[model samples]
Target: MELKILKQDFSIGKLYDVSQADLQNEFCFFAKTDQENSLVCPTEFMPDDMIEREDGWRAFRIQGILDFSLIGILAEISSLLANHKIGIFVISTYNTDYILIKAENFERAVRVLADHGYEIIH
Candidate 1:
Protein backbone atom coordinates (compact mmCIF):
# COMPACT_ATOMS: atom_id res chain seq x y z
CA MET A 1 0.00 0.00 0.00
CA GLU A 2 1.05 3.61 -0.64
CA LEU A 3 1.12 6.30 2.04
CA LYS A 4 1.53 10.04 1.94
CA ILE A 5 2.90 12.04 4.82
CA LEU A 6 0.52 14.89 5.49
CA LYS A 7 2.02 18.35 5.84
CA GLN A 8 0.03 19.16 8.97
CA ASP A 9 0.73 18.05 12.50
CA PHE A 10 -2.24 16.28 14.13
CA SER A 11 -3.52 15.33 17.59
CA ILE A 12 -5.34 12.41 19.16
CA GLY A 13 -7.42 13.92 21.93
CA LYS A 14 -9.60 12.38 24.58
CA LEU A 15 -12.13 15.08 25.35
CA TYR A 16 -15.09 15.31 27.69
CA ASP A 17 -18.06 15.22 25.31
CA VAL A 18 -17.21 17.62 22.50
CA SER A 19 -19.88 20.19 21.93
CA GLN A 20 -21.74 19.79 18.63
CA ALA A 21 -20.45 23.23 17.69
CA ASP A 22 -16.94 21.80 17.86
CA LEU A 23 -17.75 19.24 15.20
CA GLN A 24 -18.24 21.88 12.50
CA ASN A 25 -14.74 21.63 11.17
CA GLU A 26 -14.50 19.54 8.00
CA PHE A 27 -11.05 18.29 8.92
CA CYS A 28 -11.90 16.96 12.32
CA PHE A 29 -11.92 13.18 12.73
CA PHE A 30 -13.45 11.62 15.83
CA ALA A 31 -15.53 8.90 17.38
CA LYS A 32 -17.91 9.19 20.31
CA THR A 33 -18.09 6.26 22.68
CA ASP A 34 -19.66 5.68 26.08
CA GLN A 35 -16.52 6.89 27.80
CA GLU A 36 -15.41 9.97 25.85
CA ASN A 37 -14.96 11.41 22.40
CA SER A 38 -11.69 10.41 20.83
CA LEU A 39 -10.61 12.93 18.21
CA VAL A 40 -7.95 13.42 15.61
CA CYS A 41 -7.65 16.87 14.15
CA PRO A 42 -5.14 19.41 13.01
CA THR A 43 -3.47 20.68 16.15
CA GLU A 44 -3.94 24.31 15.16
CA PHE A 45 -7.73 24.19 15.47
CA MET A 46 -7.91 22.17 18.67
CA PRO A 47 -9.18 24.10 21.66
CA ASP A 48 -6.98 24.64 24.70
CA ASP A 49 -9.73 23.69 27.15
CA MET A 50 -9.89 20.01 26.21
CA ILE A 51 -9.08 18.45 29.56
CA GLU A 52 -7.01 15.51 28.41
CA ARG A 53 -5.22 15.75 25.07
CA GLU A 54 -1.91 14.86 23.54
CA ASP A 55 -0.55 17.04 20.77
CA GLY A 56 2.34 16.72 18.31
CA TRP A 57 1.24 13.75 16.25
CA ARG A 58 1.83 13.42 12.50
CA ALA A 59 -0.55 11.72 10.07
CA PHE A 60 0.22 9.47 7.14
CA ARG A 61 -2.63 9.00 4.71
CA ILE A 62 -3.07 5.83 2.73
CA GLN A 63 -3.31 6.68 -0.95
CA GLY A 64 -6.52 5.39 -2.53
CA ILE A 65 -10.18 4.99 -1.78
CA LEU A 66 -10.46 1.54 -0.33
CA ASP A 67 -13.36 -0.76 -1.06
CA PHE A 68 -15.07 -2.04 2.06
CA SER A 69 -14.28 -5.58 1.00
CA LEU A 70 -10.57 -4.95 1.28
CA ILE A 71 -9.13 -6.10 4.58
CA GLY A 72 -5.81 -6.12 6.38
CA ILE A 73 -4.62 -2.71 5.24
CA LEU A 74 -4.29 -1.49 8.79
CA ALA A 75 -3.21 -4.88 9.94
CA GLU A 76 -0.39 -5.04 7.40
CA ILE A 77 0.88 -1.57 8.17
CA SER A 78 0.47 -1.88 11.90
CA SER A 79 2.22 -5.22 11.95
CA LEU A 80 5.21 -3.74 10.18
CA LEU A 81 5.40 -0.83 12.57
CA ALA A 82 4.78 -3.02 15.58
CA ASN A 83 7.71 -5.24 14.71
CA HIS A 84 9.83 -2.11 14.75
CA LYS A 85 8.18 -1.16 18.07
CA ILE A 86 6.57 2.06 16.81
CA GLY A 87 3.18 2.87 18.22
CA ILE A 88 0.29 4.21 16.10
CA PHE A 89 -3.18 5.71 16.28
CA VAL A 90 -5.65 5.52 13.39
CA ILE A 91 -8.65 7.34 11.96
CA SER A 92 -10.63 6.51 8.83
CA THR A 93 -12.81 8.23 6.29
CA TYR A 94 -14.87 6.83 3.45
CA ASN A 95 -11.94 7.30 1.16
CA THR A 96 -8.99 5.97 3.13
CA ASP A 97 -7.34 5.78 6.49
CA TYR A 98 -4.89 8.00 8.32
CA ILE A 99 -2.31 6.61 10.66
CA LEU A 100 -0.81 8.89 13.25
CA ILE A 101 2.45 8.34 15.03
CA LYS A 102 4.14 10.57 17.56
CA ALA A 103 6.00 13.44 15.92
CA GLU A 104 9.19 12.20 17.53
CA ASN A 105 8.74 8.85 15.81
CA PHE A 106 7.60 10.15 12.44
CA GLU A 107 10.92 10.10 10.66
CA ARG A 108 11.83 6.64 11.78
CA ALA A 109 8.38 5.37 10.92
CA VAL A 110 8.71 6.69 7.39
CA ARG A 111 12.08 5.03 7.02
CA VAL A 112 10.76 1.78 8.39
CA LEU A 113 7.83 1.75 6.00
CA ALA A 114 9.99 2.63 3.01
CA ASP A 115 12.46 -0.09 3.88
CA HIS A 116 9.64 -2.59 3.89
CA GLY A 117 8.77 -1.64 0.28
CA TYR A 118 5.74 0.51 1.06
CA GLU A 119 5.90 3.70 -0.95
CA ILE A 120 6.19 6.84 1.17
CA ILE A 121 5.40 10.00 -0.71
CA HIS A 122 7.52 12.58 1.12
Candidate 2:
Protein backbone atom coordinates (compact mmCIF):
# COMPACT_ATOMS: atom_id res chain seq x y z
CA MET A 1 0.00 0.00 0.00
CA GLU A 2 1.03 3.62 -0.58
CA LEU A 3 0.92 6.28 2.11
CA LYS A 4 1.35 10.04 2.16
CA ILE A 5 2.30 12.03 5.23
CA LEU A 6 0.24 14.99 6.40
CA LYS A 7 2.27 18.14 6.99
CA GLN A 8 0.60 19.42 10.10
CA ASP A 9 1.31 18.46 13.67
CA PHE A 10 -1.74 16.77 15.22
CA SER A 11 -3.56 16.45 18.51
CA ILE A 12 -6.08 14.00 19.92
CA GLY A 13 -8.60 15.33 22.35
CA LYS A 14 -11.80 14.67 24.21
CA LEU A 15 -14.53 17.21 24.61
CA TYR A 16 -17.78 17.26 26.52
CA ASP A 17 -19.66 18.56 23.49
CA VAL A 18 -19.02 20.48 20.32
CA SER A 19 -21.16 22.81 18.31
CA GLN A 20 -20.92 23.12 14.53
CA ALA A 21 -19.55 26.59 15.05
CA ASP A 22 -16.70 25.16 17.14
CA LEU A 23 -15.24 23.52 14.10
CA GLN A 24 -13.10 26.22 12.58
CA ASN A 25 -10.58 24.03 10.79
CA GLU A 26 -11.11 22.17 7.55
CA PHE A 27 -8.66 19.45 8.48
CA CYS A 28 -10.26 17.96 11.53
CA PHE A 29 -11.90 14.73 12.55
CA PHE A 30 -14.69 14.72 15.12
CA ALA A 31 -16.70 11.83 16.45
CA LYS A 32 -19.41 11.80 19.06
CA THR A 33 -21.07 9.12 21.13
CA ASP A 34 -23.36 9.10 24.11
CA GLN A 35 -20.34 8.67 26.33
CA GLU A 36 -17.74 10.84 24.67
CA ASN A 37 -16.91 13.33 21.97
CA SER A 38 -13.46 13.00 20.46
CA LEU A 39 -11.42 15.09 18.11
CA VAL A 40 -8.31 14.52 16.04
CA CYS A 41 -7.02 17.66 14.40
CA PRO A 42 -4.09 19.87 13.67
CA THR A 43 -2.74 21.23 16.92
CA GLU A 44 -3.17 24.81 15.79
CA PHE A 45 -6.93 24.35 15.39
CA MET A 46 -7.74 22.55 18.61
CA PRO A 47 -10.98 23.48 20.30
CA ASP A 48 -10.87 25.56 23.46
CA ASP A 49 -13.27 23.24 25.24
CA MET A 50 -11.20 20.08 25.17
CA ILE A 51 -11.53 18.27 28.46
CA GLU A 52 -8.41 16.26 27.76
CA ARG A 53 -5.80 16.44 25.03
CA GLU A 54 -2.57 14.94 23.81
CA ASP A 55 -0.37 16.72 21.34
CA GLY A 56 2.75 15.66 19.36
CA TRP A 57 1.17 13.36 16.82
CA ARG A 58 2.04 13.05 13.15
CA ALA A 59 -0.21 11.42 10.58
CA PHE A 60 -0.11 9.65 7.26
CA ARG A 61 -2.98 8.49 5.11
CA ILE A 62 -3.39 5.56 2.80
CA GLN A 63 -3.37 6.70 -0.79
CA GLY A 64 -6.62 6.66 -2.79
CA ILE A 65 -10.13 5.68 -1.79
CA LEU A 66 -10.69 2.44 0.08
CA ASP A 67 -13.67 0.28 -0.70
CA PHE A 68 -15.80 -0.74 2.25
CA SER A 69 -15.33 -4.34 1.27
CA LEU A 70 -11.63 -4.14 1.89
CA ILE A 71 -10.62 -5.98 5.00
CA GLY A 72 -7.60 -6.12 7.31
CA ILE A 73 -5.84 -3.09 5.88
CA LEU A 74 -5.75 -1.34 9.20
CA ALA A 75 -5.02 -4.55 11.03
CA GLU A 76 -2.08 -5.31 8.82
CA ILE A 77 -0.53 -1.91 9.30
CA SER A 78 -1.23 -1.75 12.98
CA SER A 79 0.17 -5.21 13.49
CA LEU A 80 3.36 -4.24 11.76
CA LEU A 81 3.74 -1.18 13.88
CA ALA A 82 2.88 -3.12 16.97
CA ASN A 83 5.68 -5.51 16.19
CA HIS A 84 7.98 -2.52 16.15
CA LYS A 85 6.58 -1.23 19.43
CA ILE A 86 4.92 1.76 17.81
CA GLY A 87 1.40 2.62 18.89
CA ILE A 88 -1.05 4.22 16.51
CA PHE A 89 -4.18 6.34 16.63
CA VAL A 90 -6.46 5.95 13.65
CA ILE A 91 -9.17 8.02 11.99
CA SER A 92 -11.41 6.73 9.26
CA THR A 93 -13.09 9.03 6.79
CA TYR A 94 -15.25 8.39 3.74
CA ASN A 95 -12.20 8.35 1.52
CA THR A 96 -9.53 6.58 3.53
CA ASP A 97 -8.00 5.80 6.91
CA TYR A 98 -5.30 7.91 8.50
CA ILE A 99 -2.78 6.58 11.00
CA LEU A 100 -1.22 8.83 13.58
CA ILE A 101 1.99 8.03 15.40
CA LYS A 102 3.67 9.89 18.20
CA ALA A 103 6.05 12.49 16.83
CA GLU A 104 8.93 10.67 18.53
CA ASN A 105 8.13 7.49 16.63
CA PHE A 106 6.99 9.00 13.34
CA GLU A 107 10.22 8.69 11.42
CA ARG A 108 10.91 5.17 12.59
CA ALA A 109 7.38 4.11 11.72
CA VAL A 110 7.80 5.51 8.24
CA ARG A 111 11.05 3.65 7.83
CA VAL A 112 9.55 0.41 9.05
CA LEU A 113 6.58 0.68 6.69
CA ALA A 114 8.84 1.45 3.78
CA ASP A 115 11.09 -1.46 4.64
CA HIS A 116 8.07 -3.72 4.75
CA GLY A 117 7.21 -2.87 1.12
CA TYR A 118 4.75 -0.02 1.60
CA GLU A 119 5.44 3.08 -0.47
CA ILE A 120 6.07 6.18 1.63
CA ILE A 121 5.54 9.62 0.17
CA HIS A 122 7.00 12.33 2.36
What is each predicted model's overall lDDT from 0 to 1?
Answer: 0.85, 0.91
Q: Which residue pairs in model 1 clash with each other?
A: none
Model 1 alpha-carbon drift over 4 Å, by segment: 24-26
Which structure among the candidates has the greatest TM-score? 2
Q: Which candidate gets the maximum lDDT versus the true structure? A: 2
**lDDT by residue (tens digit), candidate 1, 1-122:** 78998988886677766672267765788788888787778888777777578999998899999999999989999998999899998888899998999999999999999998999897
TM-score of each: 0.90, 0.93
TM-score of 2: 0.93
- Among residues 3 or more apart in sequence or in different chains, the pairs in candidate 2 whose N, CA or C atoms overlap within 3 Å are none
Candidate 2, residue 59: lDDT: 96
